[model samples]
Target: MAETIFADRVLIGGRIQKDVLIEIDDGRIGEIRINTSGNSSAFRVPSSCLVIPGFVDIHCHGFGPDSFGAGFASARRATLAHRARGTTSLVAGLVSSDTEDTSRAIASLATLTGEGIIDGVFLEGPFISVARRGAHREGFVRPVDLGLLSHWLEQSKGTIRMVTLAPELSGALDAIRFLVREGVVAAIGHTDATYEETRSAIDAGASVATHLGNGMPSLFARQPGPLLALMESPKVSCELIADGRHVHPCLVRYFVNHAISGVPIFVSDCLGVEGEGKHIALVSDRLVEMDDGAVVFKDNGKLAGTALPLSGILKSSVTKAGIDLITAVSAATIGPARTIGLEDRGKIETGYRADLVLLNGTSLDVARVMRCGNWVVEKHEYE
Candidate 1:
């Protein structure tokens, strides 16, 4: 099957180009002709529209891989919810859990990965920090346990693509080395690491700073914590959660623009508790709720995670954080795809997957979503 799109503005090569024609053959991009040059009949659109690559959410916890009562059916529903909101590639997130529970979640998510239900699995740690484990249950958070991690990787059948661990934990450097050796990403998150400790981890192989400004200390002038260390490395990837509540809007802007020498990408970090009226769930035997536009722990009133999907996150990123559409879209799309080594999607270039999202010019809202050369959502063209 062949389809052609005549887009007023197409995001390509990290910038926007005007009046373009994109050709698709068998779900992959065939050619991108600039300026159209008389190609007027192919999926016509006005100048008031913008087409960008479909989002790649490397971190979202929405009923995702390893939550309570998570099954293939429920997980698929969560994945589809992200898809409906312009996310073409999603990596289901698993909070820190017991070894047995983690193994089970990995098994289920690994099967989904094999079936193409999700892009991959990100285990956000049984090896993180207990003190900085925001919303991550404390009892299950432990020191870097390479034995348990090895078991998970084997059980995953090569499906666990990323793991989050604190650099300050005992045996963490060795764990980072092992993870890198096995082709898994070693991410620094939920840590109380000083700048020196963080530098050591990065030197050992930690390439990603998981949710950079969150799950870590504030960048105090005297202390100058891990935030600076992580941002100093050009090879690291900083994951930013642009949800209005997680990190302040001002900080979000700063982080997006100036905080990282490394690449900055956006993640939803959704907790899957977003629902009508009110929703409640048990997280590690603690009560968590989503209501009235907030997801929080019932006991201590601490934020659990965002209630929005990637679409809402993007909107907040642009409107609340005062980010331009071009930068915001790139951060959400190509930046994250490349961060996770998914080079085939997140671009409108030849030989890339035809995963694109059409957005309203004025509102920047998702108008239509195309995945694998098929329209997965109802047609809502920019009119």
Candidate 2:
């Protein structure tokens, strides 16, 4: 076994302590033990920085440097960029489009999965409400049909991790139940669902509320929508886009404190246009132009996607969301890991893969990223 030791003023299992040592052999965590003898020379540490577990993101469509919505090579390129940014495991999210195009994206992702890059694929729509379609193409937004979905699932060869649907739509509740029975995660989003409909969906085995507050209607003083209804579901975990543009900072703070009983996974909700420089993005065949960080469709004044990075989300989660670094990082890491049923990663512990990030100071800016014990990206190396 190839042996190595890493130590730091470590945060272990959510606590900060000194001289924490992690032993690694063959890229797996061999053992984790603390040295209380006040002796610094016992274990070899590569650096004095804090080490966090590999981050897992369940809902990033693509990274800034690459565009996946256009084709397969772009998706693979985006996946590589995301890995460099501390996303050790990710679900390649695809927006609703023509069935043929969607099939092609799935097929491309299936190829990547065979090569061990993506954990699985997440189909975000095609069964969402037309009223709350957001940036997705309305032409592609249709009611759920179990037969069609099962066929698509079959085409992917059982690699679909999650699917987002509106519960009140035709065939949605049954689809939710079917997905649950098959061990696939069903997420509720892009909906105009009433409280009763949202509750019914949860009861039917929908477990995730995708980008909870952004894609669905907000709470009313009397008639609460899917967002508040999801808050009431004990079985459902909420997905939050910590990107400051998608949600208000105060509301994010409130949700972090109150809305979720379980870990709230932070999703980027990023589009392919991101990190590719300023350009008009086509949403639903409508052109959306970005100006000074805001995306707007000139034709209708509708907001498109944000050009925000996960690092930006982490910073805002601390400064704007009133959350500490550890809690926010947990939301970004272990929360998503548990959401997708990934058993082995997302925590700094023994027997875990050494996918880690070294951030500078308290800012959470990724100065270096190591995936599976390989230094895939280093800041100074680039500088």
Please report the candidate that would top TM-score against the real structure. Answer: 1
lDDT agreement with native, every candidate:
0.82, 0.76
Where is the poorest 10-residue window by lDDT in model 1? 62-71
Q: Model 2 reaches what TM-score against the true structure?
A: 0.91
Candidate 1 C-alpha lDDT tens digits along 171-192: 9999999999999889999999
Query: Over the stretch 166-276, how does candidate 2's per-residue lDDT look in tens digits?
Result: 998988999999998888999999999999999899989999999888778888899898887788777888888776667787878878887676557787666666432
User: What stretches of model 1 exceed 4 Å from their correct place?
Assistant: 37-41, 46-48, 63-69, 274-285, 289-294, 378-383
CA error at residue 110 for candidate 1, angstroms: 0.8
Task: Give the count of colliding residue pairs in each prediction.
Answer: 0, 0
Q: How displaced is residue 211 in candidate 2, in Å?
A: 0.4
Q: Judge candidate 2 at residue 288 and give its lDDT.
A: 72
Best by lDDT: 1
- TM-score of each prediction: 0.92, 0.91
